[model samples]
Target: MVDPRRFKSRSAVNAYGGLGIGQSVTNWHVVGRSRASRRGQRAVKRVLFLAGRAAIRGDNALARRYANRLKSGWEDRKAIRDVARRILFVACAMWIRKEVYRDELVSVPSPTR
Candidate 1:
């Protein structure tokens, strides 16, 4: 596992340019229908995206988040990107605390929509 501290900031983990988490809402653009951008770490982004998909296929907080996003009318890629971003944050937190991931740490309520 990669050391979270090495990232220094959440933006580093997300790697969508030097933009912070708030800026990510506008700055982060996943290149799905075009050539890949040379900005962020493509390999890391790919891994996170895949992890999000795997999480959605299982019973976990990430899956719940994915479901909620979908229920809220988010597009598939958008919801998956949201999950990937969340997974990055959670992974960083766990790595920094030197603790294993516990689904209980995240409380995703059942989707009402």
Candidate 2:
């Protein structure tokens, strides 16, 4: 098996740093609603945010459609955060199941057998 994490350029990997929300490493707000506290690993937060944006950039992915659905009811950043949360949840499930993620399995919707 090969490592799934690969980038074509060092700058491409480093590019996410500039996308940071500039909050402390412990907590950051995607939406600062009253009485709502958001907290997580800042590095992971940035990656998830960037991943959401990337998903939105490409029109064909199911993730993009999911983001669009969320965007209709919320701000773009908030929608992306929702997508990021979904991504995080899916990732955690994959980790628990010991399954490798297949974008094909996720990106396209198929009929039930």
TM-score of each: 0.71, 0.50
User: Mind giving the per-residue lDDT tens digits that candidate 2 earns over 16-110?
Assistant: 32322223333554444232124434676678778877766765454655655664565566566555655655565575568987665554323
In angstroms, give how far residue 10 of model 2 lies from its true place. 32
Q: Candidate 2 — which pairs collide?
A: none
- Model 1 lDDT, residue 26, Cα: 31
Expressed as tens digits, the lDDT of each residue in 41-68 for candidate 1 is 6677778888889999998888988899
Residue 85 CA displacement from its true place in model 1, Å = 0.9
Least accurate 10 contiguous residues by lDDT in model 2: 13-22
Instruction: Name the 10 consecutive residues with the lowest summed lDDT in model 1.
Output: 17-26
Tell me the whole-model lDDT of each prediction, alpha carbons only: 0.72, 0.51
Pick the lDDT winner.
1
lDDT of 1 at 93: 88
Collision count of model 1: 0
